[model samples]
Target: MLYIQEMHEGMKVAGIYLCKSRTAAVTKNGKNYDNVILMDKTGTIDAKIWEPDSAGIEEFDALEYVDVVGDVTKYNGNLQMSLKRARKAREGEYDPKEYLPTSDKNTEDMYKALLTFVDKVENPYLHKLLEKYFREDAAFAYRFKTASAAKTVHHSFIGGLLQHTLYVTNLCYYFTKYYPILNRDLLLTAAICHDIGKTVEISAFPENDYTDDGQLLGHIMIGAEMIHDTAKEIPGFPKKLESDLKHCILAHHGEYEFGSPKKPALAEALALNLADNADARLEFITELFKANMQKPDSEWFGFNRLLESNFRKTGDLNAL
Candidate 1:
């Protein structure tokens, strides 16, 4: 099992990988080729079949496990594969678990930790709302547990939504302690529900891409709608409280250009936004460093579009 992260330039790639996508394209010289993305739990790498119609290439499609033979090469600072032979893998030929990226943390443990926060919500209506999804709904619980926080960015793995929710919830909980002006219950409740729409926004792996709703409405809008629909079911749910919580979800992105339907208006909404952004950026950097572990500390990875800066590892204190 040669994971994508372990691959290097000039290496011969021969393994079963999930064909994340496949597209046909024509070269300027009028030659036809297939653009493919081969994925495993470690990550994804771009691959190309220069001779798609040749005898060595067999029928395969996106989301199918494929047996591939290729050579690894560097292109524009990223690793890519030039595939020689490819075929649809038999069911027994690959483990489905190996093809999906997953969190290092335990999913059950993270869910339990998230539940503790639900327990801490002293407000009955908010507590019931949390219980309705996290404790009572079996189907939603499974999707929430398995869903990724994003299609490509931070926490993009199985159990990612749960892991990310816990991190942001923990951060909001801490913020409540330091900033007494923030409403503990509202802030924490909003944190727990902030990304709930992601369960529907991104389809489950190995097809962890945006759903139709995701492309049209996105997680913020979808999440606010989920909260509105659910809160309506809770008898005696306070209208003001429901509105505030939904505002937090709609504004968690904190800015108009960032896809937030509304900017943070409440103190708690602002706190939730800060916490969400902090966790996302920190996790993004953590994953970035992990992906570039093979490079020396002094070498700049290059300009990252998300961070809008070139990044490199800092010197180790122990070495100093």
Candidate 2:
């Protein structure tokens, strides 16, 4: 199969791909075209179907598998597709794994490491809540293992939630040593559970978009509600501890403008929010550099939202 990453100008491709998005619009000259984004494990490529009304082109919604015939061309130094013929693929036409992106880390191993943190937690209520979702609840376990951390942004892949959670928990563990003021049990518990709401907020593979509940209430709200309900089930759980844990989840996004209903009110909440942003912004900035490096002989990079300004990495690191 001709992967998008392997594509070059003038190469004709005939293969199956997942249609990530499809939009139809008329040009100023009145010619209609199907502007599309096609996806595979190598990442996404923009596609232009020049003749949308023709019989050769077929209807396929986003998330549907499709077979395409097109010439790969360079647009702004990136490879793009110009479709001569395309149609929605029939069942048995393509492998499902080929379309989805996956994490480099082992999902099972990552989950196991997460449980070790649960074992280390001294609070009985926090430990029990962690177990209910991570081990005891079969459905939640399946979704947590399968769901991506985000639709785009950072950690958008299978096992992404596990990877992100583990990273945050490790950071929290170290934070406990530096800041003795932050309670180890409370801080680590919040770290483990911070993004657990993503299991409900985002649907599993082939449809990783926001769910109805996710759209109506963001992950922060969903997580706070989940923690509140689970805390109630545990007898003798400290009221102050419950509030602190829930605050960490609520403020993990950092500010209300970013969907954090509350800013980091507790010390643990502030620590968790810092860890989350550290992972996210670092990944975003790294991708920005990788994208620029892939371009032919490219040197000076330009405005990247994650970086907040234009930057450059020249051919010679020492020359800078």
Cand. 2 Cα-lDDT: 0.84
Q: Looking at model 1, which ten-residue stretch has the lowest summed lDDT?
A: 311-320
lDDT of 1 at 156: 95
Off by over 4 Å in 1: 296-299, 315-320
Per residue, candidate 1 scores C-alpha lDDT tens digits across 1-320 of 98898899999988999999999999999999999999999899999999999999999999999999999999988899999999999989899989899999999999999999999999999999999999999999999999999999899999999999999999999999999998899999999999999999999998899999999999999999999999999999999999999999999999999988898889999999998999999989888877776665446878998899998777542331
Instruction: Determine which window of 10 residues in candidate 2 has minimal summed lDDT.
Output: 311-320
* Candidate 2 off by > 4 Å: 6-13, 23-35, 59-61, 71-80, 90-93, 289-293, 299-301, 311-320
The TM-score values for the models, in the order shown, are: 0.94, 0.87
**How displaced is residue 131 in candidate 2, in Å?**
1.2
Q: Highest lDDT: which candidate?
A: 1
